[model samples]
Target: MDSLRTCVACRRRAARDELLRVVLSGHRLIPDDRAALPGRGAWVHPTPKCLKQAVSRGVFARALRASGRLDAGPLENRLETLMDN
Candidate 1:
């Protein structure tokens, strides 16, 4: 059976493998596609819709305990590339 994780955007529980893992990287949000990055991480679906909602709702910052605005550009680019792959 697959483990479950809650999406910070939609607030829905889903299989861990089905969700993307995001970690804080010096005030920036970095997508951990491999889920191997260290430190606290936040889970979200790998879709721009979810990402936007998460950002608008401040879920990423709250979940990661970020002290400043999170730069999600890199993470978004990574997710786009991952979706293509």
Candidate 2:
């Protein structure tokens, strides 16, 4: 059975595989496509809407137990690439 994870943006729980995992790397958000990155991770639906909510509401930092601002540009670009494929 798939483990459940809560989306930081939607605040909804779903199967872990159904959401994208994001990890912080030196204040920058990085998409963990393989879910193998070290450190804390924040999950979110792989959609622009969810991404927007996560960024706009500053949920990533809170969810990842990080303080200060986080750059989501890398994550955003990764999501765009994934969506394009």
**Highest lDDT, which number?**
2
- lDDT per residue (tens digit) for residues 1-85 in model 2: 9999999999999999999999999999999988999988989999999999999999999999999999999999998997899
The CA-based lDDT of model 1 is what?
A: 0.91
Each prediction's whole-model lDDT (CA): 0.91, 0.94
| Local lDDT at 37 for model 1 | 96
Worst 10 residues of 2 by lDDT: 33-42
- Minimal lDDT window, size 10, model 1: 74-83
Question: Between which residue pairs do clashes occur in model 2?
Answer: none
Number of backbone collisions per candidate, in order?
Answer: 0, 0
- What's the TM-score of each model vs. the native? 0.92, 0.95
